[model samples]
Target: MDVCLLYFEDCPNWKVTDRRLVAIAAEHPEVVVRRKRVETMEQAERVGFRGSPTVLVDGADLFASPDSAAGFSCRVYRTADGLEGAPTLEQLRVALGLTQEVTR
Candidate 1:
């Protein structure tokens, strides 16, 4: 599985997401994680960037919201606890279908 993290330079949450992705990588050896920087408006439009820190699983936004518009800005996630800059760890695991036991 290929997981891509899309974010802009100003986004603060991308690093957090990257850290989580690193953890996930350790757990899921078969998955490859990549980071894409959306710099310009045209690039964002071209890539369908919903916002910074958008998690794309095989080029599809995993936590996409119908109300959110595509742009180059910080994205807020409606997590289980509340509004957060990035999705929670559990949320990501669930989205990626990695809820099963992490191989030791």
Candidate 2:
């Protein structure tokens, strides 16, 4: 699985996202992670870079929002606790399918 993390240099939240991705990759060794910095508006528009820290799971947004405007901006995630700049570690694990199924 190839994962691309689209980000901008100015956003601090992108670092958090990068760490979370590495943590998740530890469990899924098959996953290859790559980072792309959205430097200019033209680059953002050309590659459809939505914002800083946009995780693309097999070329699709892991957060699942295709309706979002394409630009260099910050992204907010609706997590279990509340809105956060980045997805939780657990959320990332689930997305990578590295979690075991346990009955509640």
C-alpha TM-scores of all predictions = 0.90, 0.86
Per residue, candidate 2 scores C-alpha lDDT tens digits across 1-104 of: 98888999999989999998997778678988999999898988776687887888888776757688788778888786788988777777667676753222
Q: Candidate 1 at residue 7, lDDT?
A: 93
| Model 1 Cα lDDT, one tens digit per residue, 52-84 | 899998888878867767887788887656799
Clashes of 1: 0
Clashing pairs in 1: none
Candidate 1 residue runs with Cα over 4 Å from true position: 100-104
For model 2 the local lDDT of residue 70 reads: 81
How does candidate 1 fare on TM-score? Answer: 0.90
CA lDDT, every prediction?
0.85, 0.81
